[model samples]
Target: TVLTPRVTLQVVLSRQYGSEGRFTFTSHTPGEHQICLHSNSTRMALFAGGKLRVHLDIQVGEHTNNYPEIAAKDKLTELQLRARQLLDQVEQIQKEQNYQRYREERFRMTSESTNQRVLWWSIAQTIILILTGIWQMRHLKSFFEAKKLV
Candidate 1:
């Protein structure tokens, strides 16, 4: 289901049995997002009283699957479902690999730029040191000549 751009969600539920609930949220942006909902009951023992486990899986953009009902209505075979899953996995893997490459390229460019700046700064410092040394030597020579020591 395509949700509106921005909407508020209010969820209220009470657990009676050892049942579980799952909530899935998806957005348009690509990448992985996790939305979880769990029950916190301190009155009951850790292993006792009914434990409520809520597993939430959210897939965004093209990763979202909205054709399960349609596939079921059409009575798709097991092979069809397996093939669809494989294709989706392949596509997701390709997108992830491309994103990783983009990050690496950006990191490389930033490193090169920083290295260049450091090299220029070092060169400037060397030039300033040389100029200062020359000026000090000239000033010392003039002082000695005025005092007739050289």
Candidate 2:
């Protein structure tokens, strides 16, 4: 295994102390990608200390598509290749239901513009709390009519 400009992928069959090996390759360049493995067995009874049990399963998107191994190498006729794999799984479930209806219409227009900006900020905090309770009731009724007590 050696991807990128080094290029060597699919020659897998070596691991055998209980035997398990699988190989598949497809990547044409996107960013940060690399893989390298080597054990061409210099043999002291197969590398003197044998123990490699790797169960790496990396499946990225749309169900790791193999398309029935390309409809069994294009001979096609198992019911016309299962009706072309049911029309490519109904066009990948109609592009995942149109990307979940475009993410539920962009999360319902961002929850109706955050409930209309919290209803205009609760009507501007109830008109500044009723004009600060009518300016503190005309400043305690002009300080109780200038101290005449009423």
Candidate 3:
């Protein structure tokens, strides 16, 4: 089911044996979104005739393609096949570009967080070093005075 900013769909699929289906969800919003699917049996009996299997595939946007076989069986010409292939490639490239942008954004945020942590660590180390130096100097002065060395 698709729940776009302007439209929403509440899909209800009946659970039955040997049933397979696919659904597409298109969103105008250009960000990551969750796509979910649930499958359940409605049979009341402990067991049904033989075994039941349901396969559900959910595809979003341009990732949905079930036409290559059809095109091949129809004996499409080389030029026609090339065009279809190019179209598919374009769609795939767009999807990949979006995914790359998402990853880059995530990586940038992580880099910022790591930089802040490193800055704090450096400050802590400097404070510790200064405190240690001061303590050592005071201890050495007290020892020299106790021994009347100056």
Give lDDT tens digits, candidate 1, residues 1-150.
232323343222323433444444434443333333344566575467565545545455355765677479878887897787778888878887987998899799999999999999999999999999999999999999999999
Best by lDDT: 2
Off by over 4 Å in 1: 1-63
Positional deviation of residue 108's Cα in model 2 after best superposition, in angstroms = 0.7
What TM-score do all the candidates reach, one by one? 0.57, 0.39, 0.51
Candidate 3 Cα errors over 4 Å, as ranges: 1-63, 68-85, 147-150
In model 3, what is the error at residue 128, expressed in angstroms?
1.4
Q: Using alpha carbons, what is the TM-score of model 3? A: 0.51
Candidate 3 lDDT tens digits, 19-132: 465444445565544444444556654265546554656565445655667577978887887788778888878977997898899899999999999999999999999999
What lDDT tens digits, residue by residue, belong to model 2 across residues 1-150? 434433444333333332446776555432234565555556575466666546767774446777778777987778987787777678768766876897799799999999999999999999999999999999999999999788
